[model samples]
Target: LETVGYTLVVNPKTCVVCMDRPREVAFELCGHFVCCAPCANSLGHGVTPARCPLCRADASHQRVMRRAASLHVATMADDHMHPPPPPPPRPPPPPLPRPPPLRPRARTTSLGPTPPPLPPPRP
Candidate 1:
């Protein structure tokens, strides 16, 4: 259990394969948070999709679950733990420069300059 702002949060579920780390990945089709990222990647190797270990559902794609902040704030006056302030917002990037206008290309004959008119037939 984790304490955040005097509230208790339960994070007791661990990965099914490793049984060590907490379950942080959820199968898209089965909607089960039973495996960690490494375990899921191992199962879903190559072209074959991984099957849900719990429900046997197709788990070709899975998403990682974001854990809640572990910051602990006390209710009484003696507790001094405080989360750091967030950084200031960043400025927007500058706009890109416009490209120059394109000029029209001159039209040419298909036979490539007409072979200089065959030098007047070499009379």
Candidate 2:
């Protein structure tokens, strides 16, 4: 008989707000993961409804609960199964307008057409 061994891996969950500490709190209504206890308290304790950083949902009235130490398991298999459609191509820029056509200017001299060039000097 042969036995196989496997190792379990757990990924650390970083706080979205602080990024340095682990995410220890979550808003009730929006269910968005937030920073450490201190940061979460400050954010959710405001007078007006505090907007969730991720989804902009109101988190002030909702309960702020601490998350238990657990592995944050996520998979991109769904993304592979149903991939998002590609964005539409950008439209081409408009063509520039053509400039007005050049017209031949009439030649005019202030001294009247020039005296016919003084006959040609006769030798």
- In order, candidate lDDTs are 0.63, 0.52
Per-residue error for 72 in candidate 2, Å, reads 7.2
* Global Cα lDDT for candidate 2: 0.52
Report how far off residue 81 is in candidate 2 (Å).
17
What candidate 2 gets wrong by more than 4 Å, as runs, is: 1-12, 44-48, 61-123
Q: Put down candidate 1 lDDT per residue, 26-120, tens digits, no spaces.
A: 66665666777889888857777688776667777787775343111111101312322455799999999999999999887686545555555
Residue 106 lDDT in model 2?
85
List the candidate 1 regions with Cα displacement exceeding 4 Å.
1-12, 46-48, 69-123
What TM-scores do the predictions have? 0.43, 0.39
**Superposition error at 90 for model 2 (Å):** 36
Assess candidate 2 and give its TM-score to the true structure.
0.39
The sequence of per-residue lDDT tens digits that candidate 2 reaches over residues 17-117 is 66666666665555555545666666755466576656666656444344443223111211122222355798998999999999999876676555665
